[model samples]
Target: MASSSRSTLYENLKLVDTVAKVKTTVKELRRQKEISVDCEGNNLSREGTLDILIIGTVNRKVFLFDITKMGVSAFDAGLRDLLESGCDVMAKLMYDCRNDSDALMHLYDVKLAGVLDLQLVEIDSRRKSKQNHWFLKGLKKSIEVYDHDEKSERTKKNGTEQIEDAKRNGTTIWDKRPLSPDLKDYCAVDTVKLFSLLKVFRKKMEREKMLEASERYVDYFRSYETFPETKFYRHGFLPDEILRSNPRDPKVQYNDCQGCKKKFKRARLDLVNAGEKKRANFCSCCSRIITRIENQPIPSQSFA
Candidate 1:
């Protein structure tokens, strides 16, 4: 039961097309207390388009639901039910679970529960490692080690080349009617890697007695009500947060507006309160502060 052998045996290719197939898949998924789930798509949250949903069970079986071919109805309630039930009792494995969670929420209003995000586990482990050189490892690197470097150079090179080609195509391939083998392989490996990497990570966590901590982090990850905004789409304060905090707090500092390049000292706390609320680096006069800020950076302020 080596990770590499298990991955090779599963092959990551099981297409579920019919309602009966969906029901069967759900039945199988519900029976497992641990499973890995992944999705392939282009700007999933932004475009709300998905190519495939790969669900891998603890037994190394993967169900590849071709979203385009089968349509949302094929997997809709069954898929959501599996995930919803999984959240309560099953350990759902994923890498970067936040994005996947967001995509699921946007596309189908599915809220993923009971997720064990390997990436966060890796991060938590890295943070606790005594070695100074410890760093977060990506899924590919995690899989490479589990594979014991047995992958052929040509396969690795071809994967890299194909990935670059897909990047150049810029979401075009995501919309392609029939998935090419190369793309399918790429998508399949993602879910397969989750399964394989979890074995490696789980063992490490158990050995270090940090498995509980890793599981605890998943609850923390799930608590986020909304995804933090990036800089380009940054808006000042969220209306809800703005209404919750005091605008008159004197602790708020009015520094020169980074966006307006103004020295207007008379503006008072209007801009400072706004900036602090939005977690903006500069005043609201400038571009919407281009990053999400957790309240810990500021003193005595709670993230509203």
Candidate 2:
């Protein structure tokens, strides 16, 4: 039986904080062939820290790990290896995986393999049908049919409210020690639903002959490098033609980073080439400083 505080869906869930537990969990999970994965981060930006990592097998065995609890070095080597490479598992499923993959790379300096984002599959299927619609949907809405538990009633009410509060405050709720039961339920549901959604999405992809496209889509995002947000493109706002028209002009103007006053040439042209126009001029140094601020942990405390 699940603890009364937890939903029945997570009654069998395990929390892995030790190297030994991670090793054993990976061994057992590999036997299941596939897993669904999700993560909670400090922020939505590219540099955000990955604070909570969740994995669930097809059979509903779920594991939650607080990566910060042990610090990165103390984090289970087995799990890190599994995420990076040399894992027997056949596939890892996720939904809209770009942010998660970026956070993982930012935190652990590793990338996930054998990943398939269900969102990509849905998009391909919709395109094939020539139906037009916004593709982003919350996991709860996307996989509501798979949830059969009465506990979800309470979770929907409490979890949604708590998550909204965290967003409103710009607080990292996942950084709170002694994780709250409501937050735990929210995290668990996020991961567990991925497995359920994967099963359904996989079949849909195969039927529509879009399995190949889905794989390619995931690979593209995995290798993608995101540019700075549009708001940061300041001094580099010149039209590409104008910039290129005088590539050899010795008299071309140079701009300094607003924050550091460091000189850079063709800042606007650089932004344009990156598919953005300048709203402000920031040197690479100032941009990294901003990224660090966005990725700061809650409580303003250092973990190690």
Candidate 3:
């Protein structure tokens, strides 16, 4: 249940469990310039459950579509069109869109388009300062850091505690029937605060002249294709383009790769165990070659 500070927030929270509701919600969403999007589920990925999709509007209303109940029909009822339209009119503001995009495309055949990922925006905002800019920031931390309003802070704190409690007790909270009030608030707060964070980061990006770079960073994950064979959904997996965009600190020294014996930036090198009591660094290309070679099938022993 939401606390007194957030009691009024519940008024704007709507649950779209039926197909008709999805149609109405999507229609309303189409008129907005941007919408906050988040997915809650049991391990949201290609093979995992996508139980709820939370969408927040600029007017402070949040619509939680019960994916578990409505199923693919939810997508068929204008949800897919709204998401896949790829128009400039409506942008989806999400934190990290990789896993969500993976699940959407693979599960419901919904290709997510026109996404402005706040995770990338946050990273870009910190690039000039070089304060761990390469690392992705989670939504909770972003709220605490960027959108530190009293209401947002309170909501983030309460939601995080409830979510942790649910996890510790082995609860599939998202799959619960007739979703609990606390769970609804938890989902709602994520999307709601995204609008705030987006405003904060957009201003920072514009001031720092990183708007183009930020868009490029988002485009890295905008591809509809999912590489199931690779570690595409890995949390730490970032594209080379993104790695290259990280602002290099003059204070931080570069490393020489053992494989190519070439000087490379800090973020571009990977450390691997070369042998006993020794470690070696390799660049992305060398690492890929090493991985391919190691993964190659051993030649079958000749029985002749």
What TM-score would every model get versus the actual structure? 0.63, 0.65, 0.72
Task: List ranges where model 3 is wrong by over 4 Å.
Answer: 1-6, 206-233, 236-238, 243-304
In model 2, state the lDDT of residue 295: 49
Candidate 1 TM-score, C-alpha based: 0.63
Please give the ranking of all candidate structures by TM-score, highest first, separated by commas: 3, 2, 1
Alpha-carbon local distance difference test for all models = 0.54, 0.57, 0.67
lDDT of 2 at 197: 67
Stretches off by above 4 angstroms in model 1 are 1-12, 46-48, 86-88, 131-136, 145-160, 204-304
lDDT of 1 by residue, 73-113 (tens): 76574887777654447877787554466667666667666
Predicted structure 2, TM vs. truth: 0.65
Model 3 lDDT tens row, 5-115: 235554477778888888887878888988888898887877688999989888788888889998999999999999876536677888877778767877898888777
Q: Is candidate 1 or candidate 2 better by TM-score?
A: 2
Per-residue alpha-carbon lDDT of model 2 for 30-131, expressed as tens digits?
A: 676667788886763346667778887776667877676755742445676666542234667777665676666656766666666666565555656886
**lDDT score, candidate 2:** 0.57
State the displacement of the C-alpha of residue 22, model 2, in Å, after optimal TM-score superposition: 1.9
Error of 1 at 256 (Å): 20
